[model samples]
Target: MNINLNINNKIYNLQVDVDEPLLKTLRTLGFKSVKSACETSNCGLCTVLIDDLPHLSCTILSVQCESKKIVTLEGLSEEVKIIGDFIAEEGADQCGFCSSGFIVNVISLKRLYPDIRDELFIKNYLSGNLCRCTGYEGQMRAVRKYLEV
Candidate 1:
């Protein structure tokens, strides 16, 4: 199937298998940041913003995303740079494998709830993303700093 995908603010028309996961298609197209740690959607490493909502790319079909506005971390808005900066300053990006997905999801959360500052709420919202390193303390600090700003 030939599908048109608006990814990272650019339009891509590519031929893909009907059942191909969006993660594979994106990666094949050189969007290497869309990691695929867990193909079953258990890990949030494949998360992407589809029409402004975060969705697991590994579990979504390429055909299903035809014509949708898909935003990867590379396409993140400039306004959300604070989140990235905070993460870096806090040294939260361990292994760096999950950073893209974490940052993308954080951008979605911040856009959805600009005034959300509760630690529990942030933790609960980001629970889907699992990072074995850093113990999540640094990531939590980054989120708190970003929200407080």
Candidate 2:
């Protein structure tokens, strides 16, 4: 099937498999920052923003995203410096495997809930994006600082 995808502020017209997951199609299109770890959607590593909301690319069909606006880590490169610096300063990043998805979710949090002032709310919001390192304390700290709460 042929589809048009609006990703990272750019439109792409291409032929895609009917059942192809957005993850595969996006990576194939050179959006390497949208990493894939668990294709079953358990990891949240393949998360991407669809129309300003985060969704697991591994479970979303490319065809279903035809009219949606998708955003990936590369799409939000402008934020990486600030958020990335915070994570690094707080020592929240380790192994770096979950950084992309976690950061994307953080971006969503900042955009979705701008009034957020509690760490618990931040933790609850980003619970889906898992990390095998840092035990989340540092991450929470970084997020708090990022949100200035």
Candidate 3:
């Protein structure tokens, strides 16, 4: 099947398997930042923004994303860079494997719920993304800083 995917502000019309995971298709197309630590969607490492919403690429078929706007970490806007910078400064990115997915979801959360500034809300929102490094303390601090700003 052929699908038209608008990813990172570029349109790609590529042929793909009907049952192929979007994560594979994206990585094949050079979107390496869309990592897949767990192909079963248990880990949020393969998360990507589909039409401005975060979705697990590993569980979603490439064909299912036809005509949708997909945004990976590479597609992050300047506004999100502030968050990234804060995270980096706070030493939140250890191992850095899950940073991209976490950042993508953070951007989604900010866009979806700008008024949710509580610490618990931030923690709850990021619960899906599992990070073995940094212990989430730095990440939480960065999130608090981002929300404060």
Error of 2 at 70 (Å): 0.4
- In model 2, the clashing pairs are none
For 1-149, candidate 3 gives per-residue lDDT tens digits of 87788888898989998899999999999999899788987879998999999999999998888788999988886856899899989999878999888889988898898889877888888898999876899998898777767
Greater lDDT among 1 and 2 belongs to 2
lDDT of 3: 0.88
lDDT of each: 0.88, 0.90, 0.88
Residue pairs clashing, model 1: none
TM-score of each: 0.94, 0.96, 0.94
Please state the error at residue 28 of candidate 3 in Å: 0.6
- Clash totals for all models, in order? 0, 0, 0
The runs of at least 3 residues in candidate 1 whose Cα sits more than 4 Å from the true structure, single-residue gaps closed, are 77-80
**Highest lDDT scorer:** 2
Q: RMSD to the native, candidate 2?
A: 1.2
Positional deviation of residue 105's Cα in model 1 after best superposition, in angstroms? 0.6
Using TM-score as the yardstick, the better of models 1 and 2 is: 2
Residue 84, model 3: lDDT of 86
Q: What 10-residue stretch in candidate 2 is worst by lDDT? A: 140-149
**Total clashing pairs in model 3:** 0
